[model samples]
Target: MARWRIWRPRSRAVPFLSLLLLAPLVFTGLKAVNKIGLSSERNYSRGHVTFVTVFTTYNSDPAEASKLPSNVVTVGKHSYSKVGRSMAILNTFIGFIQVSMPRSNVIILTDPNSKLTHGSAVILPIEGNYSRGNLMLQRIRSYIAFLEQRLEELETVEDINHLIFTDSDIAVVTDLGHIFEMYPHCHLALTFRNNKGQPLNSGFVAVRGTRDGIFKAIEFFKEVLEAYHLKYMEASRMLGDQLALAWVVKSYLPSAFSKFSKHEAFTVYNWTPPEGAGQFHGMPLDVK
Candidate 1:
């Protein structure tokens, strides 16, 4: 009878075909497990996230108006004696935020004279010229200051690790804590509008809490502030904050910023909504 022998592979260093095939399955399985864990509230923690927004009070006081920046003074604009629409919207925004992300911290950067108060949100007084052109610059400054302060505080305290700055009009429909896990390497995330002329919508910005991330964020904002102050052209100031942000990201930090998805930037109007977009009558997807 002929002797039967098992065939042996020439190279033992090569991985087994079975193991190679299983590698992808194992990786995919691990990814699915991580996604499930992140979605579960019991497994995920939201204490590390802090939401920030600026609520500029409509100050009619002559004294406060006097503090306007030189650019505002040059424009000769009247004080907004009657301004309530945005505030009403902001209050509604806060209500949604409180209900959706109760565990996360919310900080409202408002004028010292702002009467708007919230039970859960921390009202941080940001002193600056809240004029149309100057407001954007001040907002950037406020973010920088807050980041710097938090970095200092983080030396001893370690409760927070991410800061999400958004426009007051944006309403939260769900907890955004999953973003950190989803974009593990993202240091800064900015929402983009479809318009190429003014691509970056400063409506939402997410900053990581690492020292490098904070510094990069600060640097980028400082460049934005400088652009506003310099006013490359008279039109630069008139084009609004979005243009300035786009210019900064393109010119200074093209690779430094990541983008939020269409779902995250689902606005009520202005830009075209994505397919199967749900009704935002109650601020459901303002900034998810």
Candidate 2:
């Protein structure tokens, strides 16, 4: 038997059903933003990700840090590194890939300096300083903040296979043409850190473009954010997104990620205590 009386066509109940179907538009007046035409969104190639390399710099100003040596200065390191990273990416071109803000889905989660435009490249607006926590805490918060925004963007866009999220500190010296390869079976792809059979490191993450994978990524980050707020995790130890990610993967998503070596992925400059100091670093991917 039907859960309720099944109304025949053109019955009194029919009108009420129609109203419920259109309720979202009638009540909320949601104007969906669809500036990108069919060619970009619908057409092109299916199963191929429309690559959108991401960059975020909040409370990351290198000008002040310039006063101190690169190694000693910890604050706003990615901002200064952004100089090289942005340039390297610009110099190298990848087919079917266009780095843009409007399409990439960047939000002003916090206040920041730097104009939206930089010569031919685009920085894309300044907002959100992320001043709620200390400098170290700020990065952890940003890790969550950026994902929340990016996941939202990916959800709307159709057929985006994977989202390549790289830190502003990461620069591309060689051509990233190899990313063109298909990922039919992979859910998540990333580089740096062996993780000892664990998935850690948030510097660069390639989230599986599928809705399920992205949803998992969002949930994982939410856990990190929640831990930060509740003071469950030690702030001093959890400076970057690494520790948070380690916790999330160990506790969840243990089998979801696939790791690539630094040689296969990118390089880190100004790393280690002696020279790069692990502070000012670069990630130049190996492209054959």
Where is model 1 poorest over a 10-residue stretch in terms of lDDT?
17-26
Best by the TM-score measure: 1
* Count of steric clashes across candidates, in order: 0, 22
lDDT of 1 by residue, 169-202 (tens): 7656666666566555555666544455666677
- Residue-level lDDT of model 2, residues 24-88, one tens digit each, is 00011122323322222332213444333333334344344324345342324443254344434
| TM-score, one value per model | 0.64, 0.46
Q: Measured by C-alpha RMSD in angstroms, how accurate is candidate 2? A: 16.7
Best prediction by lDDT: 1
Off by over 4 Å in 2: 1-116, 119-161, 173-182, 192-199, 229-233, 236-240, 253-288
Model 1 lDDT at residue 169: 71
Candidate 2, run of 10 with poorest lDDT: 17-26
